[model samples]
Structures are given as C-alpha cells and as structure tokens.
Target: MIKVEQLSFSFPQKELYTNISFTLEEGQHCAFIGTSGSGKSTLIDILMDPDRYLFDGRLEMEPGCSIGYVSQFAQPDTSADTTVFEYIGASFIKLQNEIESICSEMETSSDIEPLLDKYQLALDAFDAMGGNDFESNIHKQLNLANLMKRRDLKVSDLSGGEFKLVQVMKEMLNRPDLMIMDEPDVFLDFDNLNALKQLINSHKGILLVVTHNRYLLNHCFNKIIHLENMEIQEYDGRYIEYNFSLLQTKIELQELTLAEKEEIERNENIIDNLRAIATYNSEASRGRALKARVKFQERLEARRIKAPFVDIKQPEIHFGIDHDVQDLTVLKVDQYRAAYDELLLDKVSFEMKSTDKVALIGPNGTGKTTLLRDIANNHPDSITLHADAKVAYLSQLQGEVLKDSNTLLEEFIDAGMSTYDEIRAHLAGYGFEREILNQRIESLSGGEKNLLQLAKVAVSNADLLLLDEPTSHLDTYTQIALDQAIQDYKGAILMISHDFYSVVNGMDYVLIIDDKTVRRMTIKKFKKMIYARHFDKDYLELEQQKKALETKIELALKATDFELAQSLMDELEALIKLL
Candidate 1:
C-alpha cells in the first residue's frame, strides 16, 4: 500500500500540485489524469524516483515494496548494436551469469565446499525465476508480435515506436509489485494497444498508468487521481462514471446557489419593509428596527454558500477552412512507395475528395507518419493534388517546425492570425495565460504547443488539412473541442491519430496501413479488420528471407565481388517487397 498526503511540488519555473492527497492501496488499480503539461508525468516521476523530486508531503510505501515503471522518457542504450532477442532476453542472461559465478566459486573451494551452499541458493533462485524456459518465453513474445524473423535485427535498426515496445516488453518481463506506465498508448496501433491492455489486466500487481486513451482509462482503471489547479482530486471509480457524477453534483450546486440567492433577496425585501415601517414610526422603534436588520444581514451572510469551483480558462480552437469551391478530388496517390529501413508502403493507391475527413492508423513503425509526410511533400510522381488546392498541415512533430527565435505569441502572429489581442484571447480559451504568451516556444509543454498549432490551423483558409496525432497532447475537453471543430469543418481533413474516441466520431472514414495494404473503410470496419489482423503470421517467413538475403549480400560485398553483391542486393529488395 502507498499513501500520499498534502503533497506540494514545484519545478524551476512553475508550481504543479499543491496540498494533494491520494492512495494506491492493495486491489485498487488506478490512473492519473489532468490537462496536458499539468504535471501528470511529474507526479509519476515523484513516485518512481522519490529521492529525486523535492516536495512537501507525506508519502509512505509499504516496507520492501518493489516498483517496476515503464515510461517513454526513459532512455535505454539504443546505440548498442544488440539483437532484439538478445536485448529482450537480457534478464535471463544476467541470471545465467550469476549461476555460472556461483558454480565456478564452488568448484574452486572444494573439500569442505565453502561455496557449495551459496551455489545451491543461487540455483534455486534461478529456477524460481524460470531461467530454464526464459529464452523460450522471449521467443514466445516475439512470435506474438509477428517479429520472430526480426529477432536477429539490431536494436538500433528499429523505429522509435518499435524501440519503445521492446523496452516495455523488457519491463513487463521484470513483473514487479507496482507498475507505472506513462503514455504507453502512444505510437501503438489498436492491435498492440489491445495486447498491452490484456497484459495489464492479467497482472496481479497494482497498476498506475498515465495515458490519454479514454477507452483504457474507462475500462482498465478503477480509480482516477486528477491533478488540476495545483491541487488534486480523487475520483472513486472510472472516468465516465466520475465525470457523470461530477456533472450531477455541479448541477445540484448550481440549483442550490440559485435557491440561496432567491432566499437572500426575499430577506432583503423584508428588511427594507421593516425599515420603511420604522421610518414612519418613533425614534426608538427606528433604532430597534435598524439593529434587527443588521442581525438579519449577518445571519444571511453566514448562510451564504461559496462557489464549488473556479472558472477554468480554456483555449478555444476554431478552424476557418477554405470556402472556395474547387475540384471534387482534392488529392490522390498512385503506386506510392517509401522506405526507411524496411518496406513501409508499396503500390499504395488512394484518393480523397474535398469534403472527406479521413484517419490513417497502423501499428508502430508501419509508416503512418511517413505516408503523411510523403503526401505533404508532394513526393514527385508518387502523390497528386489538385493544382488549386490550398493545404495546411499540423505535424505530430511540433518541435521540428517551430523555431527557437519565436515565442508562443510570435508563432501565433506569424501564422497569419489577426491582432495579438485576438490571438491571445483565442489562446486563453485553450488555457493559455498572459505570462505564457511571452514564454519561448521550446518552453511550452507538448499540449500547449499542440494547441498553438491548432490555433494556427484555426486561422488558415486552407482547403485541405493534414493533422498527425492532433489529440495526443489535448485533455478530454480540449479533444472534444477539436473533434467538434473538425466535424463542422467545411474542408477535408486527413489525420493520423490514435485518439480512439475522436477518430471514431470525428472522421468520416479511416485509412488503415496494415503492412503493404492501404485500406479505406469506416471506423467500425477498420476496427474489425485490425482485430483480425492481430493474428501474427507470415512475419517469420518474410523475415527469414530478408535475413538470409542480407547475409549473402554482405558476404558478396566483403569478397569484392561487385556483380554477385548486386545480384544478392536485388534478391534482398525482392524479399522486402514481399514483406
């Protein structure tokens, strides 16, 4: 059990949570939620590294309680040229090494066997840890991922999302008492996300995950610790339930406030009447009436109710889409192909109309982002857009587009928005303050930067909008705002996002990138397809072919046989085409 009370935290520039209290007792699986950059991650960090963060609070963990945390911010040695299998099976290796050490010592100290007892103990520990079958477990995990063929692939060769998955897999293998995962939903498609969900549900240990996934929060977490306004509020149950109850309470409070106001008005009227009566009567009566009225006023003041919540300033997002009518087909792709390390998309064909709202979704490292960028760059003959179409793109990589010289305020202005007052007022609706306007672009939180991009999108009169992971940094309400805006948007939008709820309701259709297939279907159909696609097969075969071809090509090159090397390279490419 872990109990936290009256916790207050501050960073170099901002104070986060103050006087916050919550508990993660046995059998209570929970989640952390708040506005983007509202210090949800900071709270998790405080829990993971209690000695690192300075805070004023009472935090007590059960004695000898173990914790296994998985966070996106965690850095593994990715630069090392280690195979996926070797890296994932590292725990087994460490155990084997320990066992070998004990045995060697035992052999050295014979005839009374000083190290014999230690050796037996070590062997028992290894057995308990399932050291004998751990290698097979690693193989099993890889097979589940349809990555058995890539087991020999170097860690450095995998995509960013793939690396994250590998690290998470390693942590899951550890299986400690308490597990904390921060944004595990990012970079994962519906298939991998479901797999992760199953794993979390099956784990008997306590889980404290911080994710923007609405489905996961409502389904997995039994409790929610909400961080807001430098304070914390604990909800006893799921998000949907808590939000509903909170709404009911807010309504009741509003009604009660109105009733109290009416009561105060009636009392004032009575007091006025009494005063009037005394004014026409004698001096003694007048003085008595005044005193009575003062007492009555004091009582009314005592009975008055304070408002339950402060009015939170939220930034408003409104996209002013291009109004000019143009060609029906805004964009089209014919036989598109691009690759980083492996084949991402091949012979992919698609077309989008002027008013179409589409979502592109796929598993991690499946090239959703690459496809979007290829379209945006209008990659030579691969992509075709209507000559007159105006385009606006909000990339998932906000930091890449934004420059160091610009402040949040400047970016808003440079995006062709109106006066600073108009822009700042708009930002204020999304929770930006006056002080936040002057902050450097780099200093802004992920959500804040995302909002800034949305704010820019709001002013642009582009006919087609390309948004990648737009809802990643948005809080629930903010996501709702964006969703509504997208729904009402006149122009078309092609987005790449993992926001399940938004993608389901906001977009007209979905474009699922499953390996080499580019499927255009409704959200419902897309989900069903992904569910069926989750069965991992065909991967091992293609990967083996790729590996063998790569080995031959390398050997040929090493022998200085250019003709043979070229032939092998061609074979490798053909194998990749199959994948």
Candidate 2:
C-alpha cells in the first residue's frame, strides 16, 4: 500500500501540484492522465526517490515492500555488452555471488563445520528471494511476447520496442510488490500490447501507471487520476465511465441554478439603490452613511458564483486549401515492395480515392514507416498520383520530415504564415507558449516535434496527407485536437497510428498488416475481424504453429540450454517462412 497526503511538487519555474492526496492499495490499477508536462513524470520521480527533493507532502510506502519502475522511453544498458538473459539476471547477481562464495568456502574448509551452516543459510536466503526461478520467469515473458529469438541479441542492438519489452520483462520477473509503468503502450502493436495487458492482469500487485493509450485506460485500469488546469480529479470508475461522469460535471459547473440566478439579481438591485443614494445625496454629515452603503453593496456585488475553470482552447487546425479534386482518384499502388537494408514490405497493394480517410497499422518494428516514406519520396512503381495532386507528409520520426536545426519560429515562418504573433497564435493550439517559439526543433520533446509537424501540415495546401504515427507521443487533449483537425480536413488522408481512439474516430478505412498479409477494408469490418478471429485456414495454421513453437522455445530457454534455444529459433524461422 502507498499513501500520499497533501502532496505538492515544484520545479525551478513551475509548481506542478498543490495539496493532492490519494491512497493506492494492492491489486488496484490506477492511472494518471493529463496533458504533456502535467507532472506525471515528476510525481513518479518523487515516488521513486522520496527524499530526493523538498516538497510539502507525506508519501508513505509500505516498509520492506519492493517496487518495480519502468519509465517512458527507458532504455536498456547499451554501454554494457550483455544479452537479454544476462540483463534480466543482473539484479540477482548479488545473491548468486553470495551463494557461490559460501559453497566455495564449504568445499575448501578443513573443519567444514561453520562453513556448512553458512552455506545452508545462504542457500535458504537465495531460495526465499526466488533466485532459483528468476530466469524461468524471464523466459516465460519472452516466449509470450514471441521474442525468444532476441534472448541472444545484444542490448545495444535492440529496437526501441524490443528494449521496452526487455526492461518490462525484467521488472516483472523481479516480482516487485508494486509495478509503476509510464506510457507502456506508446509504440506497441496488437500482439505485444496484448502480452503487456495479460502480464498486468495476472500480476496480483498494486499498479500505479500513467499512459495515454485509451484501450489500456478503458480495459486495464479501474481508477483514474486526472490532472488538468492545476487541479486533481479522482474518478472511481474506469476510463469510459470517468469520461461520462466528467461530462456531467462540466455541464453542472457551466450551468447556473435558478436560486443562484435570483440571488445575483437581488444583489444587483441592492447595488443599484446604494449607488443612487451615493450619487444624489451629497450632505456633509450623511455623506459617510451613503459611502458605507455603496461600499457594502459593492462587496455584495463582487460576491457572485465563481465560475469553474475552463480548459485552454483546442488548436484550430486549418488543414490545406479547400480545393476539391475533380478526378477523385488520388493515389494507386500495385504490387509495392519497399526495402531499406532489408525487405520491409513485400507485394503490398492499396489505393486511395480523393475523399478517402485510411489508416495503415502494424507492429512497431514493421514497415509502416517505410511504406509511408516510399510514398512520400515518390517511388516509381509504388505510388500513382493524379496530375493535380499535392502531397504533404508528416513523419513522427524527428528529422525525417523536418530539419532539427531550425527553430520553431523559423519553421512556422517557412509555412508561409504572416507574422510572429500570428505564428504564436497558430502554435498555441498545439500547447506551444510564447517562450517555446524561439526554441530549436532539436530541443523539443518527441511529442512537441510531432505537434509542430501537425501545425505545419495544418496550413499547407496539400491535397493528400501521409502521416506516420502522428499521435504516438501526444497527450490526450492534443490528440483530441488533432482528431478534430483530421475530421475537418477536406483532402484525402492516409495515416499510420497506434492510437486506437484516433484510428477509430478519425479513420474511415483501415489497412491491417498482420503476418505479412495486408487487408484494406472498412474500419467496422476490421474491428469485427479483430474481435472475432474467424480467420481462414492459412492464418489459423500459421497462428497454431507460432504458438506451438513459442511454447517449445519457452521450455528450452527455461532450462538455460543455449544449444536447444538456438535449435528452436532455427525451427521457428523455418516455420515462419512456410507461412
């Protein structure tokens, strides 16, 4: 159990929290949702190190209990040359070393009397801490994630998603009493996301997580802690339920009651009478009486119902010129093959009409970004655009679609906007303040850079927009803003995003890339296919083979036999090729 009382936090220039309180008990999954830089990370930092900074708060963590923390964009130890297996065992090194030392002493000692007791005690301690089954837990998670092949791969060679999985697996294998994860669903595909969800659900521990993934919020968590406008709002239900209640509360806060309206009217009448007396009656002795009456009425007049805080306005994105395409057929692709050092996509074909709103979705390490880049770079055989089509691309991978050396102000100016004030006004919709105008593109966080690209796209005169993971790092409010912009867009849009909410709400068509099969259909049909996996014989057979291979690889790795693990990998690869 963890208890936070009257918690207040501060940085060099900002006060993040003021008098916030909450209690998180075991077996409860509570999430923190807010806009970017709303102090979710800072609160996690405070929890990780209670005495690291000065704050007016009492954070009581249960004594002797362990904690596991997986921060956002948390990387593995790349400098240290180690495999996934070795990295997972890094935490248990001390116990293993102690056990080895005790056994060595017992074997060498002549008397062997004292050494025997020491060895027994050390073994008991190691066993009590679950040191014997540490690798077993790791292998289980790795197999479930279908990452058993990555066990022998070096930490430095891991992709971002792979590194995140390894770090999470280590934390889970540690068996901490509490697990705190930040943005765990940032770049996950369906399979890995399901693995993470299953892991969280199976863990019988307290979970205090912070994420913007709506699926996780709606399905995984039962409680929500929302920080907005410098206020903390606690909801007793899950994400959907909390949203419903939040709408009702906002309506109540905005509307005035009949009694309150009448009270305001009465006060206005009193103020009018008092002002009349003060203005007309100008006698010397009675002047003080009139002044007092006016002052009292003024006070009463000032006292009215204080309006609730309103959120900052969502960014108004005017995406592209309102030029409708007469020909209608915006783009066409036939038998597309994209490759960068390795084959990313093979034999994939798709098309887009002038009014189409499509989403291309796949796993993190797949060729979604590669396909977008090929289309943007105007590959000969891949893209067939109309003569009048104007193409604009937004890549979440920084420096791909933008020059990082340029300042935000410079970028906005290059977008053909008028003046500095106008630029700030435009950027403000994406949560940019005046201070950030002069900041360079490289200095911004991933989320901010993505938003800057969005702002640029908003003002462009493109008839087609190809976006890759546009909402990966944005907060909830900014995502909603972008969704609205996409809805209002006149041109055809083809985007690649892992955000379920954005994909469901903003996209009319979906292109699902799974197991090398590309399926483009209505979002409604794809959703049905996802929920009810009544796939064809080929897909079902491939899935069954993959599961069986994963199980076999899991058992082999649990025994820590490298030869067997490698053999299973060879077989798994052969089986994948057959698919």
Candidate 3:
C-alpha cells in the first residue's frame, strides 16, 4: 500500500502536477490514463524514487516496501552477455537461494520433508513460469515480431520490438509485490497479449499500468487516474467510465459557458439602465445606483469561468485508386519452403485476387511474417498483377527507415516527394508539433515515430499496401482514424496485426497459418470455426444430445440409482469418445 499526500511537482519552465493526492489500497489495480506528455511516466518515477524531479510533497509507503518497475523500452545491459533465458531465470535462482537459507536455519526437525518440498514447489514454479516453454515462447514472440530466426543473436542485434518482448518476459518472471508497467502490450501479439492478461489477473500484488491499449485497460484496471492541466483526478471506474466522464466534462463546460454569457448580458443590461438614469438625473441620489453598477461590472470582470478548447477536427485522407487489372492472380507462392535449421514455412501456395483484403492470422510463432515476406518477394515472378500496381510496405519497426540524423520533418521530406506545407499539415494531423518536427528522429518515442511513419505512408500514392502491426503503439482515437482510412482505400491491403478488434471489424478474408501450412477462410467462417473448436458447437445437434445425457446422469446420481447412474455414466463416456 502507498499514499501520496498533497504532492506537488513543477519543472523549471512549466508546472507538471500540483496538489496530487491519492492512495493505493492493498492489492489495488490502478491505471494511469492521459494524453502524451501528461506526466504519467514522471509520476511513476516519483513513486519509485528513481530520479528526483522538482517536487513539494511527501509520498509515504506502508513501513518497508519493495517495488518493481517495467519501463517502456528494454534496458538490458548488453555488455553483460546475457541470454534471454538467463535473464529471466535469475529471479528463480534468487528465490531458491533464499529458501535454502531458511531451510538450513531450521535444524533437526520433521519439517525437513516440508522444507524439501519447497524444491519441488520451486521447480513447478519455474515450469509454470514458462521455464520449459521459455525458448518456444521467445521464438514465438520474436517470430510474431518478425525477428524469429535471430535467436542465437546477441541482445544488441534485436530490433526494438524484439528486445521489448525479451524485457516483457523478464518482468513477468520478476513478479514483484508492487508492479508498475508502462505499455506492457507494446510488442505482443494476440496470443501473447492473452497470456499477459492472465498473468496480470493471477498476480497477487498491486498492478499500476499505463497503456493505451484499450482491451488491456478495460479488462485489467479497476480504477483510473487521469492527469491533465497540471492536476491529477481520479475516476471511480474503468476506461469506459473515464471516457464517458471526459465527454460529460465537455458538456458541463459548454453549459457553464452559456450560463456565464447569460449572466454577463443581464449584468450589462442593469449597468446600461443605471448609467442612463444617472446621466439623465445628474443628482446625488443616483450615486448608489452607479456604485451598484460599478460593483456589478467589477464582479463580472473578476469572475473566472472555466473554458477548455477541444480540437474535434478529423484528418482528410485520400486513398489511392486501384487501376485496371492485367491478370486476376495478384500473388502466388508455389512449393515455397523457407526455414532456418528447421522448417518454418513449408510448401505453401496461395493466390490473391485484385480486390482482396487478406489478413494473416495465427498464433505467435506460426511464421505469419515469414509467409508475408515470401509473398512480397514472390509477387513479381510468381504472379501477374495490374500494370500500374504499386506496393507500399510498412514494417513493424519503422526505426529502420528513421535514421538518427534525420529530423521528423526531414524524414518525411526524404520519403521522396511532398510539398513543405503538405508535409507540415499531415504531421499536424498525427499530433506532431512544430518544435517536434525539428527534433531528431532518434529522440522521438516509439509511438511518435510510428505516427510519423503512418503520416508518410498515408500521403503516398500506392495501389497496394502491406502493413505489419500498424496499430501497435497507437491510441484508440488514432486507431479509429487508421481504420477509417483503410476502409476508404480502394487499393488492395495485405496486413498482419494482433489487435483482434481491428481484425474482426476491418478484415474481409483471413489466412490462418499453422504447422507450416496456410488455410484460407472468410472472416465469418473463421469466427465460426474458432467458436466451434472452443465450445464444441461444430456438431450442434450432437453437442445438445450430449448435454442432455449429462443432465440425465446427474439426476440419476442424485436419485441413488446406482445401476442407472453407472449405465448412464458409461454411455456418456462412450458418447464423449465418439464425439
């Protein structure tokens, strides 16, 4: 448990937060929700006592406490030459050492057996912590990240997303009493995100998360803390509540503005009447009226009404048109086998039509990215496309294109051709400021850089687009904007994303990759298949009959009819086997 009492902090040139008071009850899970640059991370740092910024209040912890923090970026010290397994396994090693020390202190007792039991417990803990599945999970996460083949590679060799996944696994293993994570869903696919949600739910300590991922925020956090305009406010419910509260606040402000305008007009009318009477009378009796009018004017001038400027402007995006097709087959892969020491993708063949919006869907390590890259590489030779077909590829890590020397604006300009004003206006749509436009690309956050990347591509004229995890670092509003833009595009889209909502809502067709093979299905049919597998609805009448038999067996057992119960149980088991 922790408490912040009247905590105030300010920067040298700007006020960050003031009079921020909040408490985290034992086992409370809270989320910090606010726009970027709202001091969320800064507040986390203050809570953890890392680097002391300007402040004027006290943060109190309940007696002695330990805290664990997971940053947005991976901070693994590459100079130490550590593998992913070694990094995660160290937590267990420390816990095991502590258990051994405690066991040695309790000498000569029957508790020895129970103490030794801890070793088995530790082993089970390790296994459950993903020890045996460690390498597989790593490979899966990396492959979903489009960097699987580089397992033996050093930490420094990984891209940003790859390294971020490694750090996420490490944090999951730590399992600290007080855990604070900044964007835990950063590089995770759907399967891994589900795993992470389970881990967080099963965690027995405090969880303080700051993430823009709506699903995670809605599923995990019970309370929301919003930071805005140098103040921290608490919302009583989840993300949806917070969103509704924001809308409510806007409406309240509008009402207040109307009230203030009416009040001002009423005061002006009174003042006008008083002034007119005073001017006509020219007598000392009218002095009190004039004084009352002056006082009203002063009160009106002194009144401070709250009014916030909300920008509701939407972006104007123009998607390129699809030209006439020269051939129906847009892409094909025949007898394609690509792997590294082991087969990742084997003999996969697929054909694409002109208007196809194909989604590559699968679990993390099924080599979805490999299949996509293979398609992109084999597109020219294996299949014929429209004569004017142009492809725009957006990789998961846009840092490859954003070099260190290039400014945000400079990178947009270098994307080949765009007018100066056009580039500026487009960047503004993506939340880039004039000051940030001149900032070095290397200095921007992952989310900011990704937005700039989208801005570049959105302005480009291309008939076919290939996007890999385009919604990874985007906020909900930005994600909706992207969804709208994609829907408006007449061009064919080939995308790989882990956001289930985006996939379900936007995709028309899906390609399921499993065990080195690709299975094509319509989105509706795929949903039905998934439901059938999960709930045994594949054969609806058979499932219903099985349920009826199960209920009859339960009733028979309650009636103390041994023969009937036994017979029914046996028949039910047989039916289960047959199904």
Per-residue lDDT for 5 in model 3? 79
lDDT of 2 by residue, 42-97 (tens): 78888888889799979998787788999777866668889888887776767788
Q: Local error of candidate 3 at 318, Å?
A: 5.9
Superposed by TM-score, candidate 1 places the C-alpha of residue 372 at a distance from the truth, in angstroms, of 1.7
1 or 2, which is superior by TM-score? 1
> How should the candidates be ordered by TM-score, best one leading?
1, 2, 3
Instruction: Report the lDDT tens digits of candidate 1 across residue range 1-579.
Output: 888999998877788877889888776678887777788877888887789977998889977777877775554576798888888878778778987887666666656365777677777877876778877877766666556777899988776666666676676666666788888776566656665665566556678888777657656778887777787778777765565454434445555666788887887887888778776776886778778877987887797765332223445777775466554999988998978767878988999999899998776677788888877765669789888888888887886556657987788777777788987787777677777788788877677778878877777788889998888767766776787789888888999887666676678898887668688888667555544654234543454465456556546544645567666655665654554
The digit string of per-residue lDDT tens for model 3 on 307-371 reads 32222333343456535534365555566666775677776777666567778876655666665
TM-score of each candidate structure, all chains considered together = 0.80, 0.79, 0.69
> Could you give me the TM-score of model 3 versus the true structure?
0.69
User: Could you give the candidate ranking by lDDT, starting with the highest?
Assistant: 2, 1, 3
lDDT of each: 0.73, 0.74, 0.66
Poorest stretch of ten by lDDT in candidate 1: 306-315
lDDT, model 3: 0.66
